[model samples]
Target: MKSTLLSLLRTGEGEFVSGEKISDQLGCSRTAVWKHIDALRKEGYTVEAAPKKGYRLAGEPDTLSVHQLKSRLPEPSFVKDILHYPSIHSTQETAHLLASEQAEEGTIVLADEQTKGKGRLGRQWHSPPETGIWMSLILRPDIEVRSAPQLTLLTAVAVVRGIKESLGLDPEIKWPNDILFNGRKAAGILTEMQAEPDRVHAIIVGLGLNVNQDYFPDELADIATSLRLEKGEKVSRTDVLEAILKEWDWLYRMFLKEGFSSVKPLWEAHALTMGKEITARTPRETLKGVAVGIDDAGVLLLRTKDGKLHHIYSADIEV
Candidate 1:
């Protein structure tokens, strides 16, 4: 009911909607409308209330909520169910639990801040309050466990396309699942899966994007940056999230129909490590070589100095 009232105020277009009219439209008492308006004001929304004119929405807060995201999204089916939080230990953990309970494929777990966010190889991800995008997507793909790694590559393609479409900035994919901008880490993707020996149960793709953050910690100051820092202004998290979901829906559908071959070209076109001398670091050892390309199953290919080609299934690439 509060969400509906808020939506009505926003759609009022800067003109005051009379309290009687709002009550009539919402089928609620005038006092109930006043209470919701007060709540919106406390949530950082600049709602102006005039006794005779009623309430008008002057401004909105830079917060991510289910209602806010749904209002902005063009396609409703992409977000069947969204679990939003002001703070959480990890969206990934919550998403895994929801998936285990048979949540729909397009359900999302999103948060304003993550207390224990993580990236690939168990590295900590910095997710401050109300600054970046920290969310997890639950997907139940009908693919083999062997083909699950390709979903990471698919997510990278969707994120890059989303950033391009929303901000008009071209970011590069760093090997498996990192997005780089101007040689700095702008976003990270971590893909986790639950599978049997041959079939996949669910794949949770977690994305931590630096959207409107203005600063980072001393440790990340040298290597990390945000979209606001790159764009010279604050970018909308809602727009970025909407764009990514739309792109992911389209790309995932194409991948399901035509296989990974259909999406490989786009991933390679924006790949940053291709044709560059780099170091691939796995848990066992590190190898220095030139990145050639990805194979049919989305494994990276590297050519060593000794003219040997190595098919890297999992590693962190340093270019």
Candidate 2:
């Protein structure tokens, strides 16, 4: 009922929607309409009501519904389209389909709740309702297929920078792309690419950020932490999302102008894995070494105890 009422209110686009019309459209009594309106106000919605003018949606709170998001971000930085869902199987799955259908570059898919959220290594990312930012971006950069991995690193730098500036809290990046605070996971990025031989097609970048969760499930309670838990107060998902998108637009423009070298140092500055001794587990074998740095190709440089430097393309790092 709130969804339907919200839709009707948005149809007005700041104009007043009469109580009689809303009741007729929703097939509810005038009193029921008033109750729903009051409920929305209690949830921090700004609704203006008058004797004869009926109700006007002044503004929405920090919810991530498409209407609120579109209204809050009146001018998009670089995003082409924003497709929002109340609940989805996976933003990445829907983005893959959209990209295949030639959706414009910078199309974003966002969900309030993901029933089957995905993580690295085929793990499930727990995304509770109204607690996090779950979104996927479709990017069609004109670069070689080998260079797509750098986009992940670039995104990492943007997330850490956005969080620091917006929330005034310190956060670090765990390569290839994980946002960490106080040695616990706060956010993760998954980058998937579709390419043709010797050319590139589209890259789908998925970001899951735990913002205001009060508690996690038993299994994730120890391994996962939300921005609220880390900061000891509630955090706004909309604010964080807006900051990240803006920073991403700026960094992405830099990458397109100067290439990955421009983003390389920025990523290194936020990386928590740099100059640390860790064990890296790849598909082939496991190696223990001190993390030196990343190459221009975005591969990890690990110096083993034998003074040998090896490029690690993919691995699970245990620090």
For model 2, residues 1-319, the per-residue Cα lDDT tens digits are: 9989999999989999999999999999999999999999999889999888789998876578565555655364568789999899999999999999998899999998999999989999998887899999999999998889899999988888889878988898888878988778999999998889787789999999999898999998887888899889877787888788888998998999999989999999988999999899999999999999998888999999999999999898888
Candidate 1 C-alpha error for residue 25, in Å = 18
lDDT per prediction? 0.89, 0.89
Q: What tens digits encode model 1's per-residue C-alpha lDDT throughout 148-242?
A: 88999999999999999999989999989889998899999989998788888899999999998888899999899888898898888988888
| List of clashing residue pairs for candidate 2 | none
- Backbone clashes for every candidate come to 0, 0
TM-score of each: 0.83, 0.82
Worst 10 residues of 2 by lDDT: 67-76
Instruction: Candidate 1: give the clashing pairs.
Output: none
